[model samples]
Target: MYKIVKPLFFSLNPEAAHHTVTGGLQRFTKIWGAKSLLKNLYTVEDKRLEREVFGLKFKNPVGLAAGFDKNAAYIEEMAGLGFGFIEIGTVTPRPQPGNDKPRMFRLVADEALINRMGFNNQGADVAAGRLKRLKNKNGLIIGGNIGKNKVTPNEEAVNDYIYCFNALFDYVDYFVVNVSSPNTPGLRDLQEKAPLTHLLNTLQKLNEQKESPKPILLKIAPDLTDSQLDDIVDIVRDTHIAGVIATNTTISREGLQSEDALVQEAGGVSGKPLTKRSTEVVRYLATKSNGAFPIIGVGGIHSAADAIEKLEAGAALVQVYTGFIYEGPALVSDICKGLLKNK
Candidate 1:
């Protein structure tokens, strides 16, 4: 059980444990039809759990958020883990080492994580190749969360996004434009209206050319102002882009059970501390857009109640990253079951 494995995983360095768990799951799936077995245990087939958003059909509304399977490494395994979908990557155009080690830390007491991982990925091209081969077939929705590299200047950020966008076009079900991460220098600058809208329009132009154009959604940080979110709504309409992801992660450290030194260790804070802000963003988007566009809620979802709150707040679907880390794979089925109950 994940409960038994949680402490052992927590004992190791966060990054190392991530690789170990992913690798182990990948191996497990390779032998004896692992994913199928997991589906038998975790997946609940109920029409109420099905959702259609941004032209994609999700078997369930509960998804594993981006940053969990950055390289598209464990898609099938994660899909088997009962996630209705999985969003992979904040992948850059070119692969980079990302920030230095010890960039990911756990504030266990707060049931949260602070990551300055700086888009550590194997690049868009590499990810696209893998995704092309390991495509999902069991109605498991997959989203590609794309971003510019840390070294890329803000002025030329659009080029980086374009590269990833073009590369991943044939593979992913949806796209999440991620310019909200706090670790990348000057990255947040892209969140401003002009740069953000321009970048999205360019991608939209390129996406329109494809016979079957994919949904393009922007992922904003929880720290943005109401004015910024208003700009986002305006941009979404202007560019004819699909929708919004509501949040990436927050730079704020407010309302923490963790000590100041622990919380101040540097990086974006996610988990319980992010719940309110992220949900607020979702509600604001729902209200501002007047339900014109859909929203995929992400941030501090730790329970079925959190997932449902996002739906009630107007998210067409919902995702969990920090919650999965803190609560385990069972959280996926729990949310799905709760949704079924509510229905």
Candidate 2:
């Protein structure tokens, strides 16, 4: 069914097609029988698929990555699609329109996508309110991925992070600090050692103050050097962060089969081409840290083998975005079933 419908979605503008599918799912799930129907078709329930990481029990280790559901809008719909978890937002303290149009592009030949979304989202308050209204999450773990507003200077970035963190504290099971996206002007600069340490430390302090604090994880870019990754290990240990989400999108267009014109677009690239590099990053962090902390491996995970590769590389959990777009809902069940088979 997805294969048949995919061409139609592919015919539309990349971003438009995204809204069309997500919006449809959102509405469809609201119908009386739709949610269960989707679950019956896509969910693969088995005790063997359960995974416990960072004090959270996931029905399965496969989760939807952050950027895919930037707002907390489609949690129920996504929950029905068999994901053990769903992450929402690179949400800001305040709403912003993000970058200008043509911000998302697809590299059809490469089965990849390039996006310069720049943390565009409805404010944190709005997402928190929506989450508050959600009555049934079907045991799906929800992670809040937060980032600074584009207008907020890097010096005051901590305040922005704190605002979103506090607002979402009561809502999400865990949090991801995003300082890796390439589209946001000067955003990646926050990934430097001093600022990165300070940011995670500040959030950790706030988290500790909570009566029951939630886990905090750092999301890093694949573009980082080995030395930078070493710094990340130290920061995670020093700040006492929960774990690391190994790899956000990459700015590198190193080896893409796509046309140069599309490849040259100014955005972070994600999908098939990212498989090897992202796995390398995961292995580096997992190996270098001696598995000191957990790692949520993401990027280029499109098949069961791809997911198991991440697990073998030391990812406690895995996430999918571009692959979900290209392969459709069946990918989730395929991965879970594959995990059971391998086990």
Candidate 3:
């Protein structure tokens, strides 16, 4: 079904195609028996697929990464596609319209996407509300990816993160702190050693106060140096945070086959171009820390082989966003099926 519709979707503008696909799915599921039909076609259920990570049980290790359903609106719809988990939001304490039009671009030639979406989301409260109202998550683990508001100054960024953390605390199973997005001005600056430590420590301190604290993971960038990653390992150890998401997106555009026009687009690049580097990052973190913490590998995972590479490289689980767009809905089942064969 997705193969039949791929061309039509690819013909639309990348961002428009996204809205159309998601909106269309929202509408399609309204039909009688559609949800179960989709589940039977797309979901791969097996006892072997289950994974336990960070004190939570996942039906599988394949997750829908942050940014795909930024506002938590598609949890139920996306859940039908058979992801073990779905992360919503690069959400903020307060809502803000992200970067202007054409913020998302497709490098079809490279099976990649460049987005400067600037964490455009409907705020933490709204996402929390949606999660609160979601009737049946079907055992899907949900993660809340939190970030500062665009207007939040770097000096006070911790406050912004804290606000979002508190708001979504009860709704999400885990939390991903996003301080590495290139689209957010000065946001990556927080990734520097001192500030990053401060932020995580603060969040961790608050987390400890809770009766049932959730796991907190740091989302890092692929551009970090080995020394910086060493710092990341140290920070996770010091703060006692849950783990790390190997990479967010890369700012470096080294080898892209797309036209210079699209390649030069100002934003973070995701998809195939990120494959090697993201796996490299995952391996580095896993090796550097001696596998001390879990790493959720993402970026450029268009197939189960790609997902397994990361898992072998030390990622406990993996995620897909750009790959889902390029590979269509069946990518989820294909990946799970591959894992079963390989396992």
Candidate 4:
């Protein structure tokens, strides 16, 4: 069904199609028994998919990656589509038009996407409000992936993160600090040692004061070197954050099967070409962190094999973005069931 819908969707602007599909899903579930209807198509509840991390028990390990439902709009609908978890936002303290429209593109030839969406989202407060209304069930876990606005300069980015952290604290099961996306201007600079440590430490300090501190994880880029990853290990240990999501999108264009011009389209590359590099990052982080921190692996995972590869690489959980777009809802069940099978 997604294969059939892909052409029609691909015909529209990537961002527009995204809203249309998400909005449609939101409405689709409102009809009587619609969720049950989707369950027949996409649902799979199996023990192998159950994962425990950061004192939270996931119903399943396959989570919809952040940036898919940036505002927490389709949590219930997507949850019905068989993801054990869904992460929303890279939301900021304030809403802003992200980089201009053509910012999102498909490299279908490579089963990939290049997006400079720039953390475009409704403010954290709004997303938190939406999440607050959702009836929490043990079946799904939702993570809030937070980022600063493009207008927030690197030096003061921690304030923006703190705002989001405080706002979303009660609503999400976990939080991902996103300083790694390649889209927002000067955002990646926060990944450097001193600044990165400062940001995570600020959040962890705030988290400690809460009666039930949310699990905080840092989302990183695949472009970091060994020394940088070592720095990340140091940051995670020193700050005592929950874990790391090893890897956001990558800036690397190597081995892309897409046209040269298309590959050169400016943005972070995500999908098939990202698999190896992302997995490598996951493995590297796992090795460096020495199981002291958990990892949520994302990037280029499109199948059961791909999902398992991340688990084998030491991911406590895995997320899908472009793969979900290209392969559709069935991908979730496939990955989950595959996890069950191997177990």
Candidate 5:
């Protein structure tokens, strides 16, 4: 199916192709049995695939990472293609248009994408409202990946996270604090030890106040040094957040096979170029923390073997974004099938 349409999609610009697929999927769902057809073709159901992580039960460990469905608009559409979970947003307290045109570029040769989207999303309240009305999410675990608006100053960043956390609290199963993305200006600054610790601790304080506190996981960047990773471990322990998502994207461009122009384009790189580094980050976090907390491994998961490698490195679950694009919708079921085979 994807093979047939891949070329047509590839013909359009990266961003346009994205909108085309998402829009097409939205219209596709209007047809009766469309969802059932997708499920039968793409899903692999089994008792063994179930995962219980961070006080939440997932039908499988495979999840659609943030940035794909930023507005929570396609939970039903994506759910039909079979996913244990779907994370919505890198959304902010207020909607922002993000970076200028040509912000997203496809490196087809490298099977990667470079996006400096700068947290282009419709705001937490809009996403929250959409999630509020989402009805087809039967067993799909939803995660809210929250971030501060680009215009929000670092001093007031805590308030941005607070607004998103409180707004999406009722809708999502878990929360991901996104201070890792390299796109947003000064956003990654919060990933520093002191500010990062303060942010997580503040959120943790609010979380504890609730009768049922949900898991709050921190997302880190691949560019961090060993010393910084150590700080991450300490921060997690000190704040008592749920776990970590080992890596958002990389700012490095060491050995990419893509052309110089695309390679030189500024943005975080995600795809085959990141596979080894991402797994290394996951392993580092898992080992450094001595498996003290769960880790959601995400970065260049293109196949089941990739997913398994992340798990073997100590990730409790794994997510896909670039892989989902380069490999297609069947990638989820393929990974599930591979997991079943390995089991």
Candidate 6:
């Protein structure tokens, strides 16, 4: 089904096509029977698929990664699509338009995407309000991926993370500290040891203050060196945050078949090209840390084998973005089915 309409979507600008598809899904879900229909077609329910990580029970280990629904606008629609979980937002304290147009590009030959979205999103407050209004979440876990506004300097970044964390605390099931987006100027700088620890520590303090505080996880970039990953392990242990999402996107365009101009477009690259590197990151973190914490594996998951490869590489869970775009909603069921069969 998706194969037929993919060309049409590919014809439009990438970002425009994204909005159209997501907006259409949101509207379609509003119809009386749409949610049930989608679920019936896509969801794979089995006790064996359940996984408990960071004290939270997931119906399955496959999730929709952050940046898909940045504003928490399509939680229900996404839930109906059979994801075990849906993460929303690299939301900031305030609304921002993000980087200029032509921010998203498709690498058709490589079966990948390059996006410099820069965490563009409606403010955390807006997302929190929308979450508050949700009538039936249907036990679908939601992770809030929070980041600082582009205008906010890195020095004052903790305040931005705190504001977003506090605002989203009650609404989201868990939180992902986002300091890895390449498009945001100096955002990746927060991944440095001193500042990274400070940021996670501050959020941890706030989290501990809450009765039954939610889990906090760090989202890292695949571009990090081994030493940086080692530091990340120590940071997670020191801060006692929940786990890590290994990773966001990559700044590397090492082996893409796309045109030089398209590949040169400044941003993070995701999709098939990311598979091996991302899995390597996950395996390294899991192995180095001795499985000290949970890891949500994402990037380049377009098939069951891709997902299984992530799991085998020590990812407690996995997420999809570019794959979901290219393969359609059936990818979710396909992955879950594969897991069940393998198990």
Local distance difference test values of all predictions, in order: 0.89, 0.94, 0.95, 0.90, 0.93, 0.94
Clashes of each: 0, 0, 0, 0, 0, 0
Instruction: Return the lDDT, model 5, position 131.
Output: 93
RMSD of each: 1.1, 0.7, 0.7, 1.1, 0.7, 0.8
Where is model 2 more than 4 Å wrong at Cα? none
lDDT by residue (1-343, candidate 1, tens digit) is 8889899999998889889988888888888777778889887788877888888888898888899989987888888878888999989999999999889999988999999999999999899988889854588888999999887888888999999998998889999999889999989999888898899999999998999999999989999999988999999999999999978888887788887778888899989888888999999999988999999899899999999998899899999988988888888999988988888
Worst 10 residues of 6 by lDDT: 27-36
Candidate 4 lDDT, 98-181, residue by residue in tens: 887789889989999999888888899899999889885555788999999888788899999999999999888899999999
| Candidate 4 wrongly placed segments (more than 4 Å) | 136-138
- State candidate 3's TM-score: 0.99
- lDDT for each residue of candidate 5 in 1-343, tens digit (9 for 90 to 100): 7899899999999999999999999999899999889999998899999999999999999999999999999999999888999999998999999999999899989899999999999999999999999876788999999999888899999999999999999999999999999998888899899999999989999999998999999999999999999999999999999999987989999889889999999999998889999999999999988999999999999999999999999999999999999999999999999999999
lDDT of 2: 0.94
Q: What lDDT tens digits, residue by residue, belong to model 2 across residues 165-197?
A: 999999999999999999899999999999999
Candidate 2 colliding pairs: none
Which candidate number has the best lDDT? 3
Where is the poorest 10-residue window by lDDT in model 5? Answer: 131-140
Off by over 4 Å in 1: none
Query: What are the per-residue Cα lDDT tens digits for candidate 3 across 147-241?
Result: 99989899999999999999999999999999999999999999999999999999999999999999999999999999999999999999999
Q: How many backbone clashes does candidate 3 have?
A: 0
